[model samples]
Target chain A: MSKTPIRLTVNGLPHEVAVEPRRTLADALRDDCGLTGTHLGCEHGVCGACTVLLDGEAVRACLHFAIQADGHAIRTVEGLAAPDGSLNPLQRAFWENHGLQCGFCTPGFLMLATWMLEQPGPVDEARLRHVLSSNLCRCTGYQNILTAVRTAAQELGKWREGATPA
Target chain B: MKCPPFDYHAPRSQAEALALLARHGEEGKILAGGQSLVPTMAFRLARPASLIDINRIAELDTCRAEANRLRIGALARHARFERPVVPGPTGALLARAAEHIAHAPIRTRGTFCGSLAHADPASEWCCIALALGAEMRVLREGGERLVPAADWFQAVFTTALGPDELLAEASLPILGPDWRCGFAEFNRRAGDFALAMAVTALRLDVAGHVAEARIALGGVAGTPVLAREAAASLLGAPPTPDRLRAAAALAAEGFEPTEDAQVPADYRRDLVRAMTRRALEGSLAA
Candidate 1:
């Protein structure tokens, strides 16, 4: 198959790569672009381990073809840190809350939460739990992950009024 | 797993997309949201020789409300319904049902028209289409047709859509103030397919009696099944708790559920009854 050369803006950095239509965005981000923060747990869409932001919306990177993302802005866990490499609010909250046990699903969670926190309106605990349920973490029992997000939402003033924590 | 290699064409217009579909015929597959198709491709269950990606066709990405209907274009993603695309009870019902679909990431890219075309028995949109009597606007080279919801679905993963036809849009009634809609689904996980689901739309006359009722069930059969007899029983009757329960039981008894090892026939029947009752209660609330 002939390789299709496509340009992708990843973490605000533009890069052009040649890939076949069979190549998924997750594989392309990890291989062609050499950014492996987007993990692929299930090549299919069942697992949310390959979650990333496409044009500011969280999407499963494994569900899309690289050819489909030719002109879109892609954001991964690598983009979640500050310029000086300090942890972002969400990441810092995750660390403080002990959100991860094995850390395999952490990247996808970070990217997914990044999209959630970037939303304009405040989010209640119900909305937070519902959104965070998109990705799975086998080891954490989900309490800490939920707490980490709540903590981040509080620090960023995105928590909804009168909503109590679970 | 990597998808099988295939030729890719991103058409910038519907005409271009139809032309490509016409050229490739059965060898081509239209890539809408790819939430369902891509997974099958990754599993190598479907290996089309070419992919006609219509995402770049900007005109197809719309949800327009006409005088009495809402036309959801092929590119209207599921996430669009999260905010209630239209006003009134119909939009609220769509938003409620959309929340039950797969999680945020999947919903972000999954298209409503694609789900109708894909025709998954457990798809919430399929149930909605059946219960609401939506019209599917199918397009092809040089021609187009509207397939009513009753005749659109054929079987599991199958629809009335021809190999060369593209499901361009789905038109649903705007549902006036007299109409109230309700939807209830049961699934084990947050984003798993529903085991059994029910969608209902009821219109009451000035006397506050049920004038019209459409009830549709999903996941218990190959296609979304309409509870015609059960809906007929609701005519001219007040939607009291006992009346609704009886109708729900009748709905559950009318259909033959497809049983799997995990979900037996009796359990599915029970779910149908429960979901139907809950959906009816939801309509009353609406």
Candidate 2:
């Protein structure tokens, strides 16, 4: 089959690339565009290592075809921080709470947690745990990860309120 | 991993999509949300010679209610279920089901049609559709038809859809007033496919008599199944714990589930009961 040419938006920049009919978005991002922060774990959809935001929602990059993403915007782990390269609030909280160990699964967790915080209401622990269950961590530091989300949610709420002013 | 090579066709309209499918026949696969189909492609399980991506067809995503039925265009995003095309009891319950599906992201990209058409027995949509007695509208080269959830789902990983036919839309009967619904199941992890799942809908008459009761269980059977005998056992009675237990016991009467690592059949059998009991209690709790 002939290679299919497609354009992908990554980290706020558009890049053109020609891919085989079925190269997964994960492989194209890591190997073709050279965005290495996105890890590959199960190579199946089960592991969240290849997690990325496809149009602001978390999805398994490994399970998606690169050509299928034409005209879509994607955000990976590398985009989490400030444009000036300062640590994002979530990254700072994760560090403060020791939310990650071994760090293999941190990117996926970061993406998942970031997306979850943007959701409209108070995210209780049970709800947060249920959302995080899809992402597996070999480090087994779930308690810390849970702590980080709580901290981030509180911090985020305060930050938003402060920005709005009385 | 790379998926097997295949020519891609992006159909801009429903007519074009129908034409493409009819011409390609069984060799073409319709791409809706790609939440499940893409993964299967990576695994080399389903390699269609041609892929017709229907994302550009704006009409298929439209949702509106006509008369007593809600017409959800097949390509409607899963997130659309969170709101009402028509304000009613059934729409409210469907919103709840949409929230529990996979996760925030999956729901955003996954379409209502793709989820049902993918027909994973463990899917919440399948169970909800069955429990609510929803109907599907499908289109072929020269014809269209309606298939109820009961008739639509035939077996594990299979639907009654013809290869050249496209699911145009789904029609759901708006649940009437006095209806109560409770959905419950446990997956090994959140957003994972359910090890076993159940959705219960109950309606009580003016005198507190159970007027209508519908129960569906998934992941424990080949399809999202309506517990017929179980429903028969509770018809016209007060939906009490004892009646719920009797209905729950009938879950194992018709089918046997296969053993997988996350959950064995014996465990699923127990979960089916627990979920049924809790679902009934929770529905009544409302």
Candidate 3:
């Protein structure tokens, strides 16, 4: 198949690229755009390894096409931390609370955690658990992960010293 | 490593999209968020000659509140409902159901139309839509048609949708003030399909009496199945624990769940009882 023209703003940077119809967004991001922070595990969307934010929401990049994104804004784990390689508060909270175990599913978990924290109004623990249950983490069993989310909620709206490059 | 060779088309408007579908017929597939379609393509499960990306069509991405119902376009993603128009128990039950679908990322991109159109018996949206008595609007090249929840879903991964038809929109009647709603489902893992699921909507007057009740079950049947006889058990009765228990038992008695990783058919029937009872209690509390 011939390559299709795709123009998308990925990780805060706009890129105009050519992709075949067969390629998925995960392959496009890592191969065409050189952003490898997003890992591909379980090419099927069962695992959270390939999660990324498309237009400010988390979606399985492996299950989407590059050309399909077209004019949408896409964000990856690489876009979450500060531009200076500094850790965002959610990252620090994860580190402090030992949220990760093997770390393969860490990026997806972090992206989901960050998004959930941004949601407005009543954040009950049970409700929060139900919300986060969609993204799977095989290694850590989610106990520590839940702890990190709880700890982060306790320190809500307390940003670190300088803002990260959004 | 990737999906098979196929043509990609993005129509600017709904008319253009319908034209594309009308032309391609069975060889074309409507892409709604691609949550289900892309995977179906990657695995070669559904090999359409052309994958028409309908997400770009402006008219398909809307959540409009009609005079007496909520009209959701086919491309409206699941995550859009987290912050709903109306809030409270019984009010905006669909929004609450949308939240529990997949993960935040899937919910963010997975359209409820896609979820329901995908026709997964394990999905919460299908069961919830049926329990709420929603109407699915399907548009064809010649004309349009409306399929109620009962008629829309047929069997596993099957619906009444035809080859050249596109699911245009789904309209659900907004819950009244006297209604109480509850949703309960059990899944082994967070994002995986449910082993057994149940949803209930009840309307009670100021005297706290049961005026109407609707109960539906997913994951335990050929399609999103409704337990109407069980619901009838609650009709014309007060909202008491004994009455609720009897109704829940009737609901459970009717379900014939299949054996799978989650549980045996017998256990799922028992689970139906527990889930239905708990759902009733929760709805009453709301």
Candidate 4:
């Protein structure tokens, strides 16, 4: 019934917004922060369409209140690309591998994959499948998504090994 | 779906949180992880007039493993257990169970104690807690109390927590060196709630006979059911194939299961039997 002032850093940008206690992080990001790349599919916790990074961990923004995210760092799909607008390796891999169809679930997948790629060490097909199981993609049947993630993991690993750092 | 408007208070300390809870009483709900509560609020199933956000209370986020138990603070996220801070078989079991909770994001936000407080009959935490005989520490304005996991869960979506009380932490008993643990569940898909699940910890004596067994099943009852009869049957006896099958059968007995649109009661009972068998076999092999 009351508004709460919140300060959050979104995609390296500091934001201060006054919102009702019930306003979800996803709603704040889309409506208030003007970042619409984060999709809301189920609204409930089931669908990972509202997935975003909170302090570097992938979390369901819809499941978090905007006030709860105060003083936290958030990274949405919009932050995945370079500042100059070049697609990241994961995005490029998805594009080349036909990882997305309909694209409603791509943002969630991208954020989730980004979190996975951020982890240290090599990711095998089994680990990738297990991590990707969290996000659902009605279209593409997931083979292309798996291929895309695998390709991106390889590319990212090579980049990390100092092979033409992106 | 959007959450209905509610007054929010971010308490900085446990005392402040308790005072807020006492003042607001039933009208106030403690928000931790907000994975289950937020979705329920969005669906209008639960509408507390005020929310007491305890995430800022640093004292409530502690996770320490002691000599005999692993003390997990209420705010400790499920993701933490995926790579447990504690060592040994208990931590390994918790990590394995954490992997089966929901999705990665849900795991990142959901808390172990929050899941226990939510008391979903099919929750992995509920089953694990019951199997491990975890003790839930409750705090209030007056004092603090510890409730055993056996008496904590009352029914589906219900627990022993009072309106003015908050679950502060859960202390799960560590598995002894002689004990081995196994967990198995039957879900339609990965990340979905289990239709039926079994968590088992067994210890074998020097003579290759079952020295101790703790078995718990979920989704087949209103609360996580401890298979006392099944566990008792294996005591002092070799867990042979026939003996294990009989015990698993006993675990599915004396319970009335609720039938939902997705799964029938009979199917759930079958799953309970199968899962119990698998869990016992896995523990034995471990």
Q: List where candidate 3 sits over 4 angstroms from the true fold.
A: A81-84, A92-102, A120-132, A141-166, B87-90, B205-208
How should the candidates be ordered by lDDT, best one leading? 1, 4, 2, 3
lDDT score, residue B110, model 4?
Answer: 89
Pull out the clashing pairs in model 1: none
Q: In terms of lDDT, which candidate is strongest?
A: 1
Estimate the Cα RMSD of every predicted model relative to the unseen true structure.
Answer: 1.1, 3.9, 4.3, 3.5
Better of 1 and 4 by TM-score: 1
Docking class of 2: medium
lDDT of 4 by residue, B35-145 (tens): 999999999999999999999999999899777889999889998899856666788788878889888888888899999999999899999999989999999998999
Q: Candidate 2, TM-score vs. the true structure?
A: 0.91
DockQ order, best first, reads: 1, 4, 3, 2
Q: Once model 2 is optimally superposed onto the true structure by TM-score, how far is the C-alpha of residue B206 displaced, in angstroms?
A: 1.1
Q: What is the lDDT of residue B212 in candidate 2?
A: 85
Judged by DockQ relative to the true structure, which candidate is superior, 3 or 4? Answer: 4
Give the CA lDDT, 0 to 100, for residue B53 in model 3.
84
DockQ of each: 0.90, 0.50, 0.59, 0.77
Candidate 4 chain B has its poorest 10 consecutive residues by lDDT at: B84-93
The global Cα lDDT (0 to 1) of model 2 is: 0.82
Residue B187 error, candidate 1, Å = 1.0
Question: Per-residue lDDT for A13-36 in model 1, tens only?
Answer: 998999999899999999999998
Model 2 chain B is weakest, by summed lDDT over 10 consecutive residues, at B251-260
In DockQ, how does model 4 score against the reference complex?
0.77
Model 2, A107-134: lDDT tens per residue? 9899888888877776766667667876
lDDT of 3 by residue, B52-112 (tens): 7888888898888778788989888887786765554434676666666776677767887
